[model samples]
Target: MAKLQQTLDDVRSIELDNAFYVEDGTWIESLTVASNTEFDPETVLEEISGVSLFYSSKIPTASEELEIRRLTILANESYPFILSLILRQEAIPNRIVLQNDVFEIVATTRDWDQFRSMADEVQETLGEFELLSVTQNEEPGEPLDSGRLTEVLVSKLTSDQLEVLETAYNHGYFDVPRETSETDLADELDITQSTINERLRTAERTLLELIYGPRE
Candidate 1:
C-alpha cells in the first residue's frame, strides 16, 4: 500500500459549504476518511492565488472507486450551476482551493456556523487530520476559467458549431429546464436538426478524442 505522505502543515482549517454535501448524492462526510480532509475554500485561494489545484486520493477498495467516479460526475454536472451562482453574485466566494497532496482544502463561505459544522463533519470523516482554524480573506479572482477549456472545447468545433455550443451552454439549454429547443437553435443557426446533430456529434467526438486520446 502507498503510505500516507507527510502530514498536511499549511492548512489553516478544514472547510465546507452548503453545496459540499448536497452536490453529490451522498453526504461529503459519508466519503471515507482515508480519502478526504476539511478544507476552507476561500483562504486556500489566498495562499495560492494564481495556481490551479489538482488532487487525488487512493482508492482503497472497489466501492471507493465507484464512489469517486460518481462524485466526479456530480461535480462536473453541477459546475455550471455553481458558477452561475457566483456570476450572478448569488453565492459567496466563487471557488474552493485544495492542495495536490489531497490533504488540504480551501472553500468559499458566508456563514460561520455552517462552515464550522462542515469542519466538524470533515474532521470526523477524515480521521487523523485535524481542523486548525478558519480565517477571512479578500481578493476573489474572476470566477470563470480564462477560457482555456472552453477554447479547447470550441476548437474541436467549426466556428458555426462552436457558436451553437456556446449559445446552448450560456442559455442553460443543457440544464434542467431545457430553455432552448432544436427548432429555436436551427432557426438561429439557419441549419436543419440533422445538420446540427451531425456538427454537434463531430464536436463532441473530437472533444472526447482530445481529452481521452484516440481509441485503441
Candidate 2:
C-alpha cells in the first residue's frame, strides 16, 4: 500500500498502447508519452534511435478522413495517478509511471497464459518488468464508443426517437437488404408505417448532425 500511495502522488510515464504482433518477430504499436515537462512530438520521434513510427498523431485525433497528423504536441502532461481515477471504469491500468522512467502498457488479454506470454515479449523492448496489477473482464473485447453515443443520444434524440432508433439498429433496419423494415417496426410499436418512417428519418438526421455538426 505504501508503494501504491507513493505512485498515486506524482509520476511520469510512456505508454505503448494497443501493441500486437503483425508478423514474425515484428510488432505494430502506438506509443504515448507523458511527463511534467513539455516536449515536441516530432522532436521526440527524432530522439528515438531505431523504431519506425508507421504513423503518429496527438491525442484527440479526429477521423483520418477528416484530419491527418496534427502539428501540435501534447505538452505539460500531468497525467499520473489522477488520470487513473477519472478514466472509465472499464479501462485497466496497462502501465504505472515510476519516478520518471517506466512504461505501463495495458492491453486486452483474454487470459493469464496469454498475458504472461505478452509480458515476456514486451520485456524485451521495455527492458524488464514488475507485475503491478491485472484486470480481467468477462467480456474480452474493447468497450463501446460511449463518448460519441452519449453526446449525440442525450442531447439530440427524443425518448420515442431513441426507442425507435434502438429497435431499428438492433434489428438491422439499416442493413444492406434491410434486416427489418418500417412496416415491422410499425407493427411492433402498434403505429402506422408513415409515422415510423417519419420518426426514423428524423432520428437518422439527428445522428448525422452529430458527426458533421448541425446542418448549414
Candidate 3:
C-alpha cells in the first residue's frame, strides 16, 4: 500500500493536479489545465477508453473558473492503461472524488505485487514521476483524523447514495435558504426528482445513525 501511494504521488507530482486512494481499490486523478485550454468532454472520453465520465461541472461559478472542472470518472473497460494495470493486479476500483483541480480515488487491494506493478506501470507511462512517503491504510500525506469520518460514512453508503449526497451538498441543498431545489439537483444528476429524494432520505438516515447511533 505504501509503495502504491508513493507511486501515485510521484505520478501526480509531474504537473498533474492531484491523486489519492479513495477506498475499495479504486484510484482517481485529474490533470491541471491552463486557463485558456479548451476542454472537450467527448475528446477526453475518446482518449481514455476504459473510463466513464459521470458528471462534469465547474466550481466557484462556471464562468469564473474556466480552468478547473470537477469530473467524476468510473473505471469500466480497462482503458486509460493505468486502470488495465490495476485490474491485471486484481484490484477493485470503487469511486472517484474530484475537487477543483484535484482528483481522489478509492480502491481496495491486498496484493503487494499488484501495488508494485501499478507503480512500475505508472513510472513507465509517465516520465519524471517521483516516489513520496506513504502512510499505512491511508491516502499519502493525509492524517487519519481528517479522513476518518468521511471514510466511515462512505463505507455505509452506496455509490449512488454517496454521489447524491455530495451533489446535494455542493449545490447547497441543505443550506438555510436552500440555494438549489430537489428538482434542480435531479436535473443536474439526470435522475428523477423522486429518485433524488429517496436517495437523500436514505443517505440522511444512514448519516444520522452514524452520528447519533442507532435509535431504539
Model 1 poorest 10 in a row by lDDT? 64-73
| Selected candidate, larger lDDT, 1 vs 2 | 2
Question: Which window of ten consecutive residues has the lowest lDDT sum in model 2?
Answer: 61-70
Tens digit of per-residue lDDT, candidate 2, span 94-177 = 432323444434445556776666666555544676777766667655422222334345457776776677677667998999
Q: For candidate 2, what is the lDDT?
A: 0.49
Residue 53 of model 1, lDDT score: 26
Output the TM-score of candidate 3: 0.35
Give TM per candidate: 0.34, 0.34, 0.35
Question: Could you give candidate 3's per-residue lDDT for residues 55-83 as a string of tens digits?
Answer: 55443312222233344455332234444
Q: How accurate locally is residue 156 in candidate 1, as Cα lDDT from 0 to 100?
A: 60
lDDT of each: 0.42, 0.49, 0.53
lDDT of 1 by residue, 1-216 (tens): 001112323332222222333443322211111223433333332353232223323222222111110011112222223223332333344333233444443445556776665555555544544555667767544432322343355446676666666555656668787988767767866889887677667767888898799899
Better of 2 and 3 by TM-score: 3
Using lDDT as the measure, which candidate wins?
3
72 in model 2: Cα distance from truth in Å? Answer: 31
Q: Candidate 2: which stretches are off by over 4 Å?
A: 1-145
